[model samples]
Target chain A: MLARLNVALLGLLASTLSFAGDAISATEKQPLNLHAIGMFVLFVSMTLGITYWAAGRTKSASDFYTAGGGITGFQNGLAIAGDYMSAATLLGLTALVYTKGVDGYIYMIAFFAGWPIILFLMAERLRNLGKFTFADITSYRLNQSKVRTMAAVSSLTVVCFYLVAQMVGAGQLIKLLFGLDYNIALFVVGALMMVYVTFGGMVATTWVQIIKACMLLAGGTLVAVLAMSQFGFSFEKMMGQAVSLHSLGEKLLFPGTLLPDPITALSLGLGLMFGTAGLPHILMRFFTVTNAKEARKSVLYASGFVAYFFNVILLMGFAAIIIVGQNPEFFEGGQIGGKIVGGGNMIAMHLAKAVGGNLLLGFLSAVAFATILAVVSGLALAGAAAISHDIYARVIRKGKATETEELRVSRFASVGLGLVAIVLGIAFEKMNVAFMVALAFGIAASANFPVLILSMYWKGLTTRGAVAGGYAGLVAAVLLVVFSKSVWVTVLGNAEALFPYDQPALFSMPLAFLITFIVSKLDNSAEAQAERAAFEDQYVRAQTGFGAAEASSH
Target chain B: MSTTASQNAVYARIRKNPRFAELVSKRQGFATLLSIIVLVIFYGFFMVVAFNPNLIGQRLSEGSYVTIGIAAELFMFIFFWVLTAVYVKRANGEFDEITAEIVRDASKEVK
Candidate 1:
């Protein structure tokens, strides 16, 4: 089945290439600056070196899984910031805000809302579980094999969607920022991410994330500060300038102003908010910290940093609107939007170039590249961990595995996953990367979030129920997204779409929750009782970190 | 059964720690409520502006609205930090105690 899927995917790619005309040719004319290329290389080399050094001491599975459970709150905090602040947040949100106005704030609201939920509900529990992946937590109370299967499926689904989005974004971003061909750009990014993950594992990924987070925040802050300085640091004057440009109105105060309708806006918001807690890459970060308390502190720090950085992004977006509106000709010939000029995503890059010149533009572009690298590496790690740790080592091997053997398997899996993502990136080169990101989030929220939430909170949740719920939500959401008008028209260039709903959460989420509950309730057996007891014990241990400490001490 | 008793005893010890006891009694509940309140207020303000455009429309240009929106966003961003600072101070003073008690109890089980 997997082989068949790959073959079909390749066919789709070949057809897309034939129709689109020379995928590689589009990238040949614009050679990237040596300085920007050098900066990217420097960052990647440093990250890889640091990660390799860290990996040397990782002799045990625990070390591989949770960085020996020694990560500080502040370091973990920065890592969390890195994990959350993907290219989607840095590039996509900034552009959306610039183009759409008020509807852009909806993304901020949805994204930040998930943090409180994480702090209050999941952080401590996840930290206490002390496993490398979320499957350890969800499967603790159910049949191990069944839970692992559900987890693998959910993790793989979310990771692949996320990976494709990041890679596509990378390809487009490289072309826009550095004027590189899409194929060359994708290949370069793919190679860099593979190097980072294969050598350093979590340590390299975390450090790179930290560095990228710092760069993104610093870059955003500098732009905001510069833009404000131009306005003499007077908020009112900036508003006046903006007002003069006719950029403010009812659209700035309402949800549906930018979107075509309220339902789609609400769906977008739902996906962003619910998707945060469900994403495999983000959830896996909690396991890297030492304990529940550290996890909580890390989230607290992340929330603080994320909120501040987003504010700067909002400022930059508005600055772009006012500045760009005043000088439309400045951005007239750039290949963005429909005419290949001044698309929303290019606002930040264009702003940097206009305000600060080549130096700033080059720096910001490097930061954007790093953002893609960090996020893709994390997603790849999650996919690798899910495959090697959960599916292979735990289920297939039945817990009989040597440390060296497991590590080798994980590294190999990382390479394989990276290859798959690169291939997918090449295939879907023309699709709007943001749409893929939204689909990934939607799938995560509908398919994974429901099962994860219920499994942890509800004692009656059975193994059968989890599997049923997970697969149902996963299949339904993917099918709905694939058949939606966005995919058919925007991605495949097909006018006719089979699915009526653009967002599947309104139906798929409830369907998942209902099926899981019903299935668990109908199951009655001694094994079920045992499963319930084990789950309850795990929850109790997780709340207190008793079982984890015991295992670690041994 | 004795092991379960010891675990319960550890829980009791955690409950007996004054910092833990106080945190459990008030701090977590308060932080959770405070976050909810802030979100409500923020969303409510948006609702008001969204429902009654006339109130915000007095300001000229979509750009002015964008400016105001950005300003509000900046304020909220700072506000989250203030909230975090307050939480951190309280957590260090109170929540840390509960956390310490739990860790202490877990350490005892390990030994």
Candidate 2:
């Protein structure tokens, strides 16, 4: 059966690759960008060296999953920032700001708001309770097999959706930036991701992320400083120029120009906030630290870096309006106000070239590609943990799996997930897959966030209630996304969407919470009583870290 | 198994410690308050955008080119980071001290 599935996946890849080849050649051939390719090759070589070093030390399951839990707070914080800031944030967000003006900043504010809440409520408890995956916490006192199965399924779902989105975005962005073929880009990304995760495990993944974060920070600072220098480093002067040059003029500085309605605004805000907390990859970073102190520090550093980058993007976006938007060289056929050369997302790249020439542009392009690889590696690691730790070790083996066996399973799972991601990225190349990110966030918020949070805080939560509520949220989120306008009308060729809102968090998240609360209140089983009785033990450990997993010494 | 039993005993004793109770309650209160502050600030901005966006779009002064919205967002970007720093300082220093004391006491009781 597995072989058959592999054959099918390969067949699909071949068909998609043939069509994509034709499609690419039909368009005007982009000249090969030697500078960008050279920078990216240097980055790949450095990360592979780190992976070789990390592979030597990856000796056990703990090392594979959480890097022996030996990472310091500051290093973990940088890694977390790397995981959160994907290529989308660098490119898509800048594009949003370039086109929509201040509306992009508003979107960014919603995204950054989640970090403080995670620190305040979830970080310490998560560090204290979880050992490897977030499932370790949710299934702590519940029926291990049942609750873990649900958690693993939901986690894998979130991981797969997020991975596909990153893979597709990586393919398209690399093609545009480095003039690399889409298939070749996907293959390189998938192969490197598998190598990093299957060999170096979380140790290599964390280092890669930290390195990428620094490079991204440095690159962004250069672009922002160089571009802002043109405006005399004056925000008022930049905004005034942007306002005069932009089509929207005065309205570009406001919020109403972005979100069409109140419900969508609130829903998008809530999804981005809680979704950060619920993401399996982001949640997994807490365990890489030593303790709650490190976890909290990580969140603080992550939030600071993320917010600071947004401020940088704010400058780059406005600068691009003047720098890239006004320059005919960056636009197609030297049309100054018409479509951009490589599309809207290339505004930041164009601005880089306009300010610092080809050197900065090549550097930023490499950074963008590195950002995607780091994020996908994190996601793949999280997915592997869900499979090997939650499902295989805890559920299937019934806690009987040895460390070596679990480690073997994790490597295999990482390779499997990497292959699946590549295939899906290629197959979905011609389709509109931007909504997958939103859907992933919706599922994370509705399915994973509610159960994980409740298990930590509420004593009344039972196995049945959690499984039921989690599945409900998962199903509702997927169903709503399918029926929403983006998928229902645009992708599926339907006449009208059944769901009015593009974001399902406003409706589905509440439904999940209400169902979980009501179901737990109604449950009166003896097992429910036992789970409630066990909460005190979990509560104490969560509060003080008395019996929490200690960092393993080498 | 015996280690797990002793661990549970220590956890039970820690749960009963007055300091543990104090730590949980104090931390919980602070966390809840901070979460509320963040939510209100973020969602409040959303509400304004939904209902009265022009208010935020208005300039800071007659001469300044910066809008009230951008100024407010810039303030929030820095202010939110400060809030996290504040929570971290208290939680890592004061609350952690209490936690360490409670755990030490509870382990002694179990022994």
Candidate 3:
């Protein structure tokens, strides 16, 4: 009964993105490619096999949420890297570099700047304090009902926006790769995601991510190396040719073209930096490790892999500027220097074809599809945990729910979120939802980051302060985005935007911190006193792992 | 469990231990220092991009197509990665040792 409903939901979502118009018009009516479909089928079959194995082992809440905390640091690191480097980074950033030149590299730097800081500041304390979700840490000593509800609300918001963006992108992607209708593509992705999370849970999800990461890293390296071979493996040679061919010419090497203003640059940089630290899916990776030591190692390995992959993507983009830019076959109607076949985002795939022909392109296409699948699975799981663990078990049940009951709720929540993502994806197809990704980051930085940091490092934080600050950040981010140029002028057809900046982190993040600090200072009730007093034990556990939640002994 | 008298006593003792203070202060200082360094490096790059786009656009030397900004960022990516390794080495080694000793001392006091 539920499976039929899920399929219906996916059909609705797929049709929605089909009408999304410009967002995915590149592959609107393409025919199926047998090679691409075959490769993707192979991936789906293998992952489903892994899910079958994982479901047998997933007998408890811990296993479902975190693979029983038995994952080694290195494995967890790859999964984290897999989670972070979505299809957007692989395809969208490459397109950015392909067009904007050095500006794309600048964006990559901003995206990457968050990891080392996460390691230095949050990873250990997070591992020591959190059990299943980030709510574990925020509600550790505060009012469970209030704090958990706030965290769950913000988490679901971030997840839903992000999930919709991914689902819409997935429909477009499947159209390009497999020649399937957008609705059919959405159904396949939505169904696979639900099956992975509802049955296989985190263990299946992590392994899928790990496999996709390997494919992406390998596929990306192959494209870069093969393309760079055309330039005889010299960075200077590749840049020299790319600069001469690009329309921007020498200006491609500069920063002024993409981000002319300092405020916008700073806002974008801050949003990507701190927002990365607060993402629930990323934070949940820390709890999968055995201890604080393994958690620290996860960040170290994840950062290394991500930094290296971004650099490889830089090479692929530069190589594409020369390889794909010069080739007429990959262009629309063989018009050189004109429209690309699969839109601007297909530059990476075109470069693969130019270097290694159809086989490599087919492989990269499968990798891209797999990347989307892995990322959405992680997002769905995080969203589900927020519902089952935070809202249902802690808030609604008053922490009286049994383990089996909690796990069952989580499975239902996973399916429920997957359906919501499909419905929203379809409903917002023509709404210019490109702003959702930036909005997600803004909320993460504003609503989630401030309260999370203060709860761990500050003893003055009370339930009233944390809850108020969290909502302030959430509302401020959403309102700012609604009034910003992206939504106000482009989507809403307003004459002028209420907010000038596209990124809201600079203004809203500080506002959240200030509210949290002031409200905490004014709090003077006995409950506030008890919350402050309990901070010592939380601090001890956070510091030394004494009496911290332990890994289940299997 | 945290409200139980014995657990509370153990936590109080842990807080009172001299090594516990040392661990928290040392680790906190190191983490703050590293975090500041990262913020400076990242924000410095952004500030330069905002104020002086031309400087970053210029080639490392005349006649080279590779600009200073791209090259610097590539190195910074690797450099940021090395920073993670540096903190982890000290943290998983020295800081973790201090944490273990503090826990042991606190538990002994409770007994």
Could you give candidate 1's per-residue lDDT for residues A418-491 as a string of tens digits?
Answer: 89988999998866765667678888888888888887778888888888999998888888888887787777
Q: Give lDDT tens digits, candidate 2, residues B1-111.
A: 012889988987887777888899999999999999998998999998887878878888996777878888998889889999999999999999999999888888888
lDDT of 2 by residue, A1-554 (tens): 32343344345444544444454572422455667767877787778878888999999888999999999989998999999999999988898998888889999999999999999999999999999999999999999999999999999999999999999888888778766678877987898899889989999999999999999999999999999999899988998899899988877877754688899899999999998989999999999989999999999989999999999998999889998888899878899889888777788889889999889989999899899999999999999999999999989999999999999999999999999999999999888888899999999999999999999999999988899899999999999999999999999999999998888998888888889888988999999999999999998889898888899998
For chain B alone, what TM-score does every candidate structure achieve against the true structure?
0.58, 0.94, 0.92
lDDT over C-alpha atoms for residue A151 of model 2: 92
The candidate with the higher lDDT, 1 or 2, is 2
DockQ of each: 0.26, 0.74, 0.79
Provide the overall lDDT of each model, using Cα atoms, as 2-decimal numbers. 0.72, 0.89, 0.90
Lowest lDDT 10-residue stretch of candidate 1 chain A: A334-343
- lDDT of model number 3: 0.90
Q: Name the top DockQ candidate.
A: 3
Enumerate residue pairs that collide in model 2: none
What C-alpha lDDT does candidate 1 achieve relative to the native structure? 0.72
Residue A403 C-alpha lDDT in model 2: 94
Interface RMSD of 3: 1.3
- Report RMSD for candidate 3: 3.4
Give the TM-score comparing model 1 with the true structure, all chains together: 0.86
Question: What lDDT tens digits, residue by residue, belong to model 3 across residues A1-554?
Answer: 33454446445545544444543444444555657666876787788878888998999999999999989899999999999999998999999999998999999999999999999889999999999999999999999999999999999999998899888888877777666666667877888899999989999999999999999999999999999999999998899899888999988889855687999999999999999988999999999999999999999999999999999999999999989999999889999988888788888988988998989989999999999999999999999999999999999999899999999999999999888888877777657667889999999999999999999999999999999999999999999999999999999999999999999999999999999999999999999999999898999888998877788888
